[model samples]
Structure formats: C-alpha cells, structure tokens
Target: MIDLHLIGIGTGNPDHLTRAAIAAMNAADLILLPRKGDAKSDLIDLRRTICADVLTGATRVVEFDLPERDTSAPYLGAVEQWHDAIAAVWRGKIAQHLPDGGRLALLVWGDPSLYDSTLRIADRLRADGLAMTVTVEPGVTSLQALTAAHAIPLNMVGAPVLITTGRRLRAGGWPAGVDTIAVMLDGDCAFQTLDAPGIEISWGAYLGMAHQALVAGALAEVAIEIIEARASLRERHGWIMDIYLLRRAVPVA
Candidate 1:
C-alpha cells in the first residue's frame, strides 16, 4: 500500500508550512512535483525549495510534466477528462517509482480543502484500484493570506461569507444576503462585470510570494487600476494566480 501525503504548502510561502506538513515531507520516501510548462515553472521551483528546506529524509524528488487540459471541449467535460489524464500520469509515476508501493508526497498549493483538486484526483487513484492511504496536512489558505494582507476580516461580526469562483460572480452577479464574497480561479477581471455602486474590493496576486501585489479601494475607484496592473504583472511574470474579496457597503438607514 502507498501512503500518499497530500501536503498543503500554503500559497507559495515556505514560511506558511505547518510543523505537521514539514514532518510529513521529511517522512516521505518519494515526492512528485508537477511542472506545468514554462509559464508556470515557478510553481515547480517553489516545491523544490520547500523540499530542500524541510525534507531531511532520504526522499527521492521526481519531477513530471503536467498535462494541459483541453479547453476546446465543454467546460465540465473537459475538466473531467483532464483530471483523468492527470490521474493516469500519476499512476504511471507511482508504479514506476515505487513498484512495491511506499510512502509518497505531493506539495499542494494553498489548502487542498479549498479550490484545489488534489483530493479529487487522489480519489480517482483509489477508484482505479490503487492501494493507497491518503493523509491531508492543511495549511494557510489563500483566503487567510489575502485577508491578512489586506488587514480585513472575512465577514461581518455575525454575517455569513460566501466563497465562490470568478465565473459564478460573472454569471450570477452579486449573491443575495451574503455581503462578503471571496472570489478565486478568475482568469478575467469578473469584478468589472458588476455594477460598482457601493462596492469595495481588496485584490491580491501571487499572495504570500515574493512578487505579491495588492490593491484595495472602492470598486469604482480601483477596478480599472487593478485590471491594468494585473495585465502588466501577468505579462511580466508569464503567469498569475490572484484572489479578491468584495463587500457591498451597508446602506446607512
């Protein structure tokens, strides 16, 4: 049986790793790092850095090319197929590296419980008849990093917070009842699609990383600035991962 450790490394910050996560890394026999092409090579590099710092065990670090998803197909279908392909790649790597089945580790960005799909892919491995035991080491999520960077609470004292994707924000506009919204996985500036009336936004890109950028102000005041800044940053760095929080100002009764 393979002991699979899904370790959360936390939004690119090595310092964000918990003691438990570090211990798990040091205990793994093999650790697999996925390279998502030249545009996102920094992600692989970050994994390497973390391993170098925390992994004291005689763990073999292997790097594999991550398969690109087919965007031409329908969205949900395409993602499902992509996940299958990733699982196949993973299976091959594990079988080749640990034919006898041993402990393995994968460094996940942010918390796996958040928007990441590492857990789902792990489930696929189990479904394929792989004898594996999965363990999750939770780390600081992007929401925590974003909120900390902005020095703002995620929700009002007694109000609920709605966490969603940029696509949902675009398709449904502002969700009712929930005054605070945290948007992730947004390739486009979905905030531009909403009416900026009484809305405030706190946006952060490459959170917890060295090249972090943050912008906060009334939506009407900083929406264009954030767009131009994000575009320029993406062009300069070749890739970008960003999250933003939006809150509607409570009307003075």
Candidate 2:
C-alpha cells in the first residue's frame, strides 16, 4: 500500500508553511513536485525551496510534468480528461519510484480543500483501483492570505460571505443576499461585468509571495487601474494567479 500525503503549502511563500505541514514533509518517504512548463517554473522552485528548508527524513524528491487541459473540448469534459491523464502520470511515477510500495507526498498550492484539485485527483487514483492511503495537511489559503494582507475582515458582522468563481460572477452577475463575495480562478476580471453602482473591491495578486500586489477602492474608481496593472504584470511574469473580494455598500439603518 502507498501512503499518499497531500500537503497544502500555502500561496508560494515559504513562511506560509504550517508547523504540521513541515512535520509531515519531514516524515514522507518521497515528495512529488509537478512542473507546469517554464511559465510556471516558479511554482516548482517554491516547492523545492520548501523541501530544502523543512525536509529532514531520508525522503527522496521527484519531479513530474503536469498535463495541460485540452481547451478545445467543453469545459467539464476537458477537465475530466485532464484529470485522468494526470492520474495516469501519478500512477506511473509512483510505480516506477516505489516498486515495493511506500509513502509519497505532494505539495499543493493553497488549501487542498479550497479551489484546488489535488484531492479530486487523489480520488481518481482510488477509482482507478490503486490501493493507496491518502491524507491531507491543511495550510493557509489564498483567501486568508488576501484578507490578512489587506487587514480586512472577510464579511460584515452577521453577514454571509459567498465564495465563487470568475465564471459564475461573469455569467450570473452579482449574487443576492450577500454583500461580500470572494472570487477565484478568474482570468477574465469578472468584476468588470458588475454595474459598479455601490460596489467596492479589494484585489490581490500573488498573495503572500514576494511580488505581491494589492489594490482597493470603489469599483468604478479603480476597475481600470486593476485591469491595466493586471495586464502589465501578466506580460512581465508570463502567468498569474489572483483572487479578489467585492462588497456592495451596505445602507445604514
């Protein structure tokens, strides 16, 4: 049996690693780091840095290429095929490295329970009939890091906070009943779709990392600024992962 540990390493910052996550890394027999080409080489480099700082066990480190999703297919179908391909890669790597079966670990970005697919991929391994045990070590999430970096509370007192994706915000518009919404996986800046009447936005890119950038103000006031900044940064860096929080102005009683 292969004991698989999925550890969340937080958003690219070495300091964001938790004590539990550190200990888990030190205990693993093998750690798998995924390479997503040169555009995202920084991600793998961060994982290596974490391993260098915390790994104490005789754990061997392995690198594997991440499969790119075929965007020509429909979104859900493409994602499904992508997950299967990734599972196959994982199986091959594990079998090749641990012919006798042993413990393995993967460093995940942000909390695995959040918008990440590490757990879903792990589940795919189970469906493929791989006899392996899986465990998760939760770490700080991008949402938490964004909020902390801005020194703002996620929601108003006695209020609900909606966690959603950029696609949902773009397609369905602002959700009702909740003034606060945290959006992820939004490459399109879905906030631009809003009417921008009483909405305020707090946006962060590369939260908790060295090149972090944050901007906040009335949606109408700073929307263009964010767009320009995001474009410039993406061009300079070749890729970006960002999240933002939006709030509608609450009326006074």
Candidate 3:
C-alpha cells in the first residue's frame, strides 16, 4: 500500500516549518512538486528551498507540470475536472517512480485544513481506487501570519469571527452581528464593494516571506492604498497571495 503524506510547510518560509514537518519530509521515500508555470516559478523554487533546508536523507524529488484549470468553465465544474486531471498526473508519476508502493509526500502551502484543496484532491485519489493511506502534518497558516504581522487579536474579547472567501463577501455584504471577518482568495478586492462606514482593516501579502507588505487603518482611509499596493505587487511578481481582516468600530460600554 502507498502511504501518502500531505505535509503543510507554511507560507514559503523555511523557519515556518514545524519540527514534525521537517521530520516528515526527511522520512519520505519520494516527494512530488508541481510547477504552476514560469510566471509562478517562485512557488516551486520556494518548495525546493524548503527541501534543501530540511532534508537530510536520500529522498528522491520529482517535479511535474500541474494542469491548469479552465477559467472559462463554471467554477465548481472546472475545479472538479481539474482535480481529475491532477489525480491522473499523480497516478502516472507515482506508478512510474514508485510502483512498489512507498511513503510519498507533497508539500502544501499553509495548513491543508484551511482554504487549501490538497485534502480534497487527495480524497479524489482514494475514490479512484488507489490503495493509499493519507496522513497530515499541520503547520503555520496565513491567517496566523496575518494576525501576527498586524499584532492584533483575531477576535475582540470573546466576540465571534467569521472566516470567509471574497466571492461570498461580495455577494452577501458584511455579515450582520459579527465584529470581525477574515477574508481569503479574493482576487477582486471585494472589500471595495462593502458600504463599511466605521470599519478598520489590516491587510497582508506574502506573509512570512521576504518582501512582505502590510497595511492597516480605517477602511475608508486606506482602501485605495491597499488596492494600489496589491496591484503593484502582483504586477512585479506575476502572482500574489493576500489575506485581510476587517473589524467594525466597537462602541464603548
């Protein structure tokens, strides 16, 4: 049987790796790295850097070109098809390199339990009748990095926090009865669409990596600044990953 390990390496920082993540990487017989494209080659390079930093054994490392999702298709349908394609690629690579069934690992950015789909994709492998077992090693998440970078508590003194995506935020507006919201996977800067009056924001991009950017202030005052900075960073790097937190002003008791 093949033992598959989905190891979270955190946000592209070698130091973010946990002791358990390091041990898991060194123990694997094979590690699969997926290349998104030249524009995002830095992602794969970061993975390599992490491996170089922690691996101390004779584990084989392989790189494969990842399948691109068809943005033209419906979102859910496109994702399902893309996951199938990825599973096919994984099957080919595993059969070619480790036909005898051994421990294999895929380094995931951020915690897999978070907004990441590595876990969902892994489930596809099992559904396809691959005789494999799965294990996870959690690591630092972008949410943690964002909060730490801002030096703010996630929730205000026992207040509730809503973790959501950009699309939902744009579609549903600011959720009622919640003081805090953390947003991820927003390409359109959906916060711009909100009618927030007394809201404040703390935003971070490339958290835990060099060249990280941070901005915080009243949402009305700094919304434009954030949009400009995010655009410039994406233009310079060809890709960007960012997260933001919003809190409505709390009236004094």
Q: How accurate locally is residue 154 in candidate 3, as Cα lDDT from 0 to 100?
A: 94
Query: What are the root-mean-square deviations of the candidates from the true structure over C-alphas?
Result: 0.9, 0.9, 0.9
Question: For model 2, what is the alpha-carbon lDDT of residue 253?
Answer: 81
Query: Candidate 2 lDDT, tens digit per residue, 1-253?
Result: 8899999999999898889899888888899999999998887888999999888769899999999999899998999999999999999998899878888999999999998888899899888888889999998999999999999999999999999999999999989889999999999999989999899999999898889999999999999999999999999888898999999999888
Candidate 3, which ten residues in sequence have the lowest lDDT sum? Answer: 116-125
Model 2 misplaced stretches (Cα beyond 4 Å): none
Model 3, 1-253: lDDT tens digits are 7899999988998999989989999999999999999999899999999888888999999999999999999998998999889989999999999999999999999999999888888888889898999999998999999999999989999899999999999999999999899999999999999876899999999999998999999999999999999999999999999999999988989
Model 1 bad stretches (over 4 Å): none
Candidate 2 to truth, TM: 0.98
Question: Which candidate order results from sorting by lDDT in descending order?
Answer: 3, 1, 2
State the displacement of the C-alpha of residue 11, model 1, in Å, after optimal TM-score superposition. 0.9
TM-score of each: 0.98, 0.98, 0.98
Score each candidate by Cα lDDT: 0.94, 0.92, 0.94
What is the C-alpha local distance difference test score of candidate 3? 0.94
Model 1 TM-score on a 0 to 1 scale: 0.98
